[model samples]
Target: MTDLLLPLAFLANGLAAGVLVGTVLGVVPFYMTLAADSYVRAHAFAVGRYDPFQPACLLVTFAADVAVAVTAPTTAVRVLCAAAGLAAVSVVAISLTRNVPMNRWIRAQDPDTLPAGWDMDAFRRRWARWNSRRTAVAVLALVLNAAAAVALP
Candidate 1:
């Protein structure tokens, strides 16, 4: 079970981290450059598809990490898996609390006109910040999982 879980954890973590890093490095930056109306259209188009996929990947990653942490053969592997689990938790928490709300708001916007007093620049910056945070934690989780897998006996 431990053997099966460790590889599953690594694969899921890789998927989660890859998407996040891509968002952090490419998608967000591209969105930041777009005009307000364009941003609204692009943002709306980009988000809905991630709904069940990314969240599901993160869920699998967290579950596998927790299981590996408990059943790992060595102290180092256990600690690494536990730390990765924590990082995975952080990624989900930050996304739910920070990024998802803004995504919801943006998705609701009209492409022809933003809401009254909508500060497009501020929203872009704040969204980028939250994305970077989640991306960092996600990448950290992947690295920790890789290290844990390497440490496996």
Candidate 2:
């Protein structure tokens, strides 16, 4: 019932959430990316497809990332969490700035339309890279958070 225990518990929970997301996302990167890509290809601008659903997932992932950052006991643990968070941040940025717009455009298009100036190959490649990086970050974050919870008072 100490302050450290409470934070540690929170961190632990975040780690669990991160693991769950990593598993699901890792398995279906193409579906996730294509859905967003398709949505933006149809729409004219970024509206963040899967709006309600995606935010919750992101919240859990980011919460874990932040919890580890604050609760980790050692400098090395903190640095690891920080690096993971940076990777997560990059994924989030790419999703918002690049993928979301593309998804929005995709949503607006007919199957034949191809959403104006959409570049399917480029989007796929970029998303694949970002997703891979994000997954790595999430995995590292979970490890660091778990380590922190164990090491911290």
Candidate 3:
């Protein structure tokens, strides 16, 4: 059972990492190409779709990191698992601090009829900047999780 847990944990971490990488490389770029209203609408739609699955992925990955640390076969494996867990925590911190508020602000606006004096360009720029940073953090977490997996005996 302990042996099986490591592989399952790795699978969960890998799946979460793949989704994060895909969002950075695929979804964000596509969203950037749209007109302001379209971008708003598209993102709102995308978020609706993404919210269902992404949170589960992150949770599983985070939980698995803890599990790995608990079941680690060696000191090095425990350290690697702890590092991976820290990285996962960082990803959550970035999302809550940077991404969630921005998303909430975006969701509050009417995509079809943005309010007067709305600074669409600023919104786009800021969102992009924060998203890029979040993506980088997620990538680091993914790498750390991968390292932890490799260190498992």
Q: Which candidate ranks first by TM-score, i.e. highest?
A: 1
Give per-residue CA lDDT, model 1, range 1-113, as digits (tens): 77999899889889988888888878988997898899998888888876556777888889998998898899998999899989988888998999899999988888886
| Candidate 3 residue lDDT tens string, 4-95 | 65566566666666776787788888887888888888878877776556556666767777777887788777777677667666767777
| Better candidate number, 1 or 3, judged by TM-score | 1
lDDT of 2 by residue, 50-97 (tens): 444443554554555556667666676566555555544554565577
Q: Which regions of candidate 2 fall more than 4 Å away from where they truly are?
A: 1-51, 60-87, 115-119
Clashing pairs in 3: none
lDDT of 1 at 18: 89
Q: What TM-score should be assigned to candidate 3?
A: 0.87
lDDT of each: 0.87, 0.51, 0.71
- Give the winner by lDDT: 1
